[model samples]
Target: MFSLIVGLVVAVVLIVLNIVLSKLSFPKEGRILAILVILVGYIYWGFEPFAHHEMHPHVEHASYSFDGKQDIEALEHAGKDATEIKAFWATIAKIAEHKGDAVAGKALVTANCTGCHSIKSEGFPEIMSDADAAASYGVTPPDLSIAGKVYDKNYLIAFISNPVKAMHIEHKYPVGGEKVFPMPASDFMQPQEIADMVAYLSDAAQKVPAPTVKKGASEFEISKAVNKEVFETACVRCHAMNYAGIHAKTTAEVMSKYIGATPPDLSQYIRSRGEEYLHNFINDPQRKLSGTGMPRVGLTEKAESQVVEYMTQIGDSKKDEREALAPKVLIYLTILAVFALLWKQKIWRDLH
Candidate 1:
């Protein structure tokens, strides 16, 4: 309604401006150009409210809740020791090795996980594209083909059980605020079901070769390299960087179609979000903006720090050099101002 009023006012103002311009003593071409511009402006103003309404349609968010405290209590009751989570996973792995059913896991994956994630090069036959998925869910769901190797089995179990808890433990980063958009807990799944899935993932991991590590790089270089790898695996599907030749035209169109807004480029995200906020947001996006499309990437503390370092370097690589030159520039300006004042006084003395 406000947009409609503004649009109406703008249309009126354009009409008045057009009338005034028409009466001006200008050349025929100039007058025609002025009227055409006003017409275009009026048309845009008339349609802007409609476009605005379409872009931001009124919709109610469904009421959803998660009881983290209850979840923790349940874990405690089940003798799930946080310190021995890995040991628990080892036991599960041993059991799964003997009796876990890969066929059952495959059925579960097809029914639940296939909706958002794909294990193969060809993604699931969904209505939206990979870009759309990323726009909707913060990042595209990673291929599970190598996920078993990429993440620890213990962490995987915890994550599958309760993603929010796992993420909090891994990064210790807060969300935007109190509001959170946590992944739905798999509390519905039975222990046997989760174990079967784990078995499938572990077996899949064995089939794939391990990623080769590049050696001899400096710490900064290593951070950047890791950041690049992380970004490609997680972020590249959604957010694009100018340095990486990923830019507005491609991402903007896809994002606007899916999310109603384009995600900001990471090239200067550090400047906008800052280190602390970035850390917090990366850990849990819901803490900052509850309904935000950005999801927690679930990076470890070290990985999160590396990502921050990478963003900082890319965002303000010349910050140190710029700061170093500040004092010298100020001194030079001070000298110039003093000389200018002296010259002005000398020039005005004869006049006075």
Candidate 2:
């Protein structure tokens, strides 16, 4: 709607300018070119809204399917040890130390998560297309290849056990008028199994090597490269960043249909949401907005800080350079203005 209004205003201004120019002594060729530009711009404005209609696709409210009995039965079949599971849950709740067996985690991941998520670079074929997955769950399940690297182990364990509960999201429809929680709680899996999954992810995905910065590169440039990698690996799956020139149109369309809205562009998100708000929200969005469709991506303390810094830098990349040159620019402009005033006075005095 904002884009439409801006396009209309631009088209109207161009039309008015063309009319005014027609009455002036502008060259025929220049007049024709200007008129043509205005016509083309107006034509584009007429179709601009439809061009991005996929960004705001209509969503229908649907019933969620949850079977507590079936989930309990599955948990029983998995040989859940109640005492061990309780202890593990308690440890995670208290943020206490607990050991996880990556070997056991690999087995658990194969048995449970492989159906929905792919871990390695290549091997398992995707069971569903992006559209199909979005239709089923509001968003495509992201690849888990680097999950361990991006997310904290404690958060990962808690999330895997009960995503909605861990994130403090309400288990209901219309969370922001069109949002839904599609990822089910893994309560069916024993707490030990959840820890094992986190263990495997930590071993396989955590601590992605930073991009090498060339010697004498600016801090902004190096930070940009690192953050670009982070966004591509984790964030580009859902959000679009126009400044970075990333757009996932098809994915956004399907997601809009399922989740009731496309994920917002992140180009100015840091500026709009502010650093503190983003920190808490990114840590756990459901905690901030109880029914928000945004999931916890499990960023660790360091990774989260880097992500925020990268976003802030990109959103206002020119700010530092602009501030550094402001005083010099003002001095130069003042001298230029003084010279122009003197020249004007000299010419007018001679005429008088």
Candidate 3:
């Protein structure tokens, strides 16, 4: 913001300088050259602000963050966020210590989770279709086919234990961070049981690889479609891009209440917020906006890149055309300025 303000100040000063130079026998062409010289600094400052902005969440860094490498215990059984965070991480730490038995997990998951979720590649299908699921739960449950491969290992464990707290959407969900979520918290299950379920999902994901772009396919189709699957897998539950003809499975009114407001139509957000902010915001929403209902969607880094690429393609692909035109505009101005300077020199010599 400061840089943009400074750049505008410099631009105003140059316009004033051009007016002064015009009266002193400098031709318009010569004034163009003078203005261009003055603009070099403005060019840098004007564009620098958009290149990147370092943003951090309002939360104090040390308050709730944990490295997970240390032995931590709950300092108290209280309602404080700090204490809750410590307990959460400590539980995650304990879960990490156990090795999962996928065979045992398959049975447990079938009994506990398959009613809500489906592992299609493993031949398990949910009792209800997506529409019914949305009607029943207010959001269609995501398939678990790629969850193991695409989500962060730590995040998956945390999500299973406390969806509201782990996703940082407690403001929208129940206070205990346990009941009433689309998927009930498995806090009753042992940490090892949770790990086993994660392991079974991971093993299943590995056994059946995800769809891939075919070699020698049309680049036009490939470029547009490559990241789309990733976007759908990660973002299409409650958000929609109407320009792209992608509708949310959950209706607007349902999501409006679910998240405290209808989520914005994300068609032009790339142009509005730019890619850098989206990257950081998606990585951790609370960092950018405290109490934001958007989850810290636990996509792996690669999947996050793919999702952003898809958003950029649909939201602001014209940015390339605008960027491509800028240099040509600058070049044309330089050529015109050169001609103006030459004419000014001739007139000055003739006056002398």
Candidate 4:
């Protein structure tokens, strides 16, 4: 839980003490104590196997202009669809070069996407109901009302061009794999067409009210519902958390067909995977597990944090209690250590 910082700090202190002790002569009875300190320091930073460097996990993270740095989208370099990687990159470049016509995009949306989706704010209701859509496509299609606002624009552009490339799931594109993606790639549409649809969506989404900041509600409000909305919107489409009474719209079997395996219920993930891991994984699935069926979900930092907090609330109900008791437990241990040291000194005094 300390993330090895305490261990490293203790090692450093012992190393410094070791240097000072090396210059002094310890009493014969106390010589073993100095040796023990040196041995502990060696284990902390030394004693690596010959291939430790090679086998150690090289956990790397990729960033984008979304992180407020520059315009490098990490997923742009991920899975390619056959020999079309070059063309896909060029399409992305073209999409960036061109500005979309929102009005024209609205028409393109009517012609192309409204069969599965709905933009009620723009007077386009879903052609298929959730039940009907689920039966036909194995999962209900999401409303595009806020897609432009919530999703990363670059990701949206790439996803519209080719989902297989935007999401690193080329493994599922083979002959026997789940080749039936509900949202087909808009191969008939050029880069301009793709941008226009996104533009219409982006333009339309502005009409819908934005999601709450949620941090204040999670803290002072403590309603739990406010914090959980992020998880519901971002995660509930695919994964279920049965313990939290959150079920996926699609059945487990159908979800397996979509992603090669049914996504695991995220009930006990707070226990199995800590908050740090959840943050990284939620931000970008490929960052933690490359080629995962899960896409980047494209949540802001606040939304992502809310999901973690929701998970903590559901799965880690004891967190507050545990935190309150931690200091008392540490205090007891410190007192016991002090007593042990005094007893050791008393015995040594008698021996000397």
Best by lDDT: 3
lDDT scores of the candidates, listed in order: 0.61, 0.68, 0.74, 0.71
TM-score for each candidate, following the candidate numbering: 0.44, 0.58, 0.73, 0.68
lDDT of 1 by residue, 1-352 (tens): 7777877787788788878877888888898998887787667755674685666453222111122333344458778864444444444344434455677877777787777776763244554666666566644566676566445554566567766555443232244544333245684677778777766776765675433457776655665665655455555556777765654323566555544567788998989877867766775565555566554555555556666777777787777679899999999999999999999999999998
Query: Order the candidates by TM-score, highest first — what do you get?
Result: 3, 4, 2, 1
The residue-by-residue lDDT of candidate 3 on 1-352, one tens digit each, is: 6645765677788888877987787777778888787777556655564344323323322222322322122223233346557767778878967898889888888888888887788898877966778888878888787777767777788888877767767667767654367777777889899999888888887886545667887664486685776777688888898879999877878776667677777888888876777777787776667678788777777777888888888887776788899999999999999999999999899898
lDDT of 2 by residue, 1-352 (tens): 7666777688678878988999999999899998997788677656664564535342221111111222234347778744544554565654324467788988888888878776644354567876676566666677777778776676677677667545444443424545546666676766667777778778776444567888999878888887776666567768878887887533777767654577898999888877867777776665456577776666777777778887887787777888999999999999999999999999899798
- Report the candidate with higher lDDT, 1 versus 4: 4
Model 4 segments beyond 4 Å from truth? 1-56, 65-83, 120-131, 175-178, 210-227, 279-291, 295-306, 317-352
Q: In model 4, what is the error at residue 308, expressed in angstroms?
A: 3.9
Error of 3 at 71 (Å): 17
The segments of candidate 2 whose C-alpha lies over 4 angstroms from its true place after superposition are 1-91, 94-97, 122-129, 171-181, 207-219, 286-291, 326-352
- Tens-digit lDDT track for model 4 on 129-198? 6667777886777777766765667777877877665665666564256465667877568778888888
Residue pairs with colliding backbones in model 2 are 148-206, 149-205, 149-206, 151-298
RMSD of each: 17.0, 14.7, 6.4, 6.6
